[model samples]
Target: VTIIANLELKKQQLVLPKNALREAFRISHAIAEVTNVSSSARQPYVGVSAFAHKAGLHASAIKIDPSLYQHEDPASVGNDMRMLVSDMAGRASIELKSQELGVDLGGDKELIGRIVDRVKEMESRGFTFEAADASFELLVHEEVNGKRPSFFTIEHWLTTVERAEDQSILTKAEVTVTALGKKIICTGIGNGPVNAFDNALRTGLKQLYPELEVLELTDYKVRILEGRLGTGAITRVLVETTDGKGEWNTVGVHENVIAASAMALEDALTFGLLRQGRKPE
Candidate 1:
């Protein structure tokens, strides 16, 4: 569960993630028993569809009463019912999620309607929200209030690779970002391009978010959502981050792995600062 939860908590059953580890150990043990064996795609309680609702007749009944389709209350197992909004899901699902996430859909039904349409279009392109709630939350935030002020904006980043005198490879990176409308630049070196990029980005803003000093990247993952798209296939990046307290997951998707990784990394750092309510120039 540590490995999975570090990346995405929802995948780890019974754990109250991103909030507290109150039941993390017990829940991980229970999850081990369920996941140890070869089980069906639809497991008893933690499977993807264990508490998921489609946008069809079943969803219709769920809207009226959840008990209609759900054999048992998910809350009893420490999991709440959720919906996977796809092309088929009705507006009710999004509205319900808005209530759940506390997004202020308010009186603007048409605005949410547009967001729903946008989600469907993205799903059609193989961009899924099932494992990327951070990205989804950002999307909701953007749709509701437009782009809110971010911690900083990247002016540019550059990387160079060359052979050292001893015939070993050397990668160097330089990054500049604008925080509080002031430009800051820093340079770094790493084993490879991505590593160098990560280093430079962090060094550039260490003064702004000193928490970055304690931050750690526990794990990273990349997936090609659609092979048929070839070079245009969307890449989803999952990054696990921690400040030695607890771990949280952030995700990004793009046509380029580097770009996707950058997005996830940025989100992870941004989330870290937000969690601590820290802001610096």
Candidate 2:
């Protein structure tokens, strides 16, 4: 009887009823739909990954029926599924990608295999497809068409930099380019790598293409890979340029920041030309 006099207090539990839970879900879905509608009206930049996929099984299933792997129809997202072929892929996948590239794969198995192996090896060395470069695409085209750039070659380049307390850092870059059966040397000074290199390159190429002024740099970005403690680690550089007609992105990677930047700039120029239907020499 004395034990019954003592009692323990328990905390009250709060829970949503089934009906209330269902109503909450409906309200959240409605809010998301409204938000998406408003965002679509703003016309924001949508990336390829918005609809791109990489899973092998998913790719196979999508080839059969896109609905099997995708949450929304690619058309709804204004995108499509892309199947990439590499050494990791099967022959079926290779065939599909080859067909997409408009290559006759019926008798080109060896070539296709070689391309796949090359792609795999390059990708392992930090190459990527997230931002597909038309210049690299052109290289693939050339490899398939047996045509490649040979009109011009860089014999050598020399860059000199000087720092002053007051004025901007003076950068003088000189380049020797061989083109049209002749070797030409050009020099220019600018505030940075891009400007200096561009000034020099334009001076050299202007004689070949008088329309050099039409080309303009649109965007530039440098990314550090495995970067820690602000050290200049492996860096990937991207440059976007346009000739008032079309725009393209080109990429380069290197341990040397200046060298990587220079390579990216060159890639941008080369890609810009290719986009205009001009074959790089």
State the RMSD for candidate 2.
13.3
Query: Where's the lowest-lDDT run of ten residues in candidate 2?
Result: 1-10
Clashing pairs in 2: 151-281
Expressed as tens digits, the lDDT of each residue in 142-210 for candidate 1 is 788776426878778888899989999999988888886679997889987778988998998888777
TM-score for each candidate, following the candidate numbering: 0.72, 0.68
Indicate the residue-level lDDT of 197 in model 1.
82
Candidate 1, residue 216: how far the Cα is off, in Å: 3.2
Off by over 4 Å in 2: 1-48, 71-107, 165-167, 228-232
Deviation of model 2 at 47, angstroms:
4.4
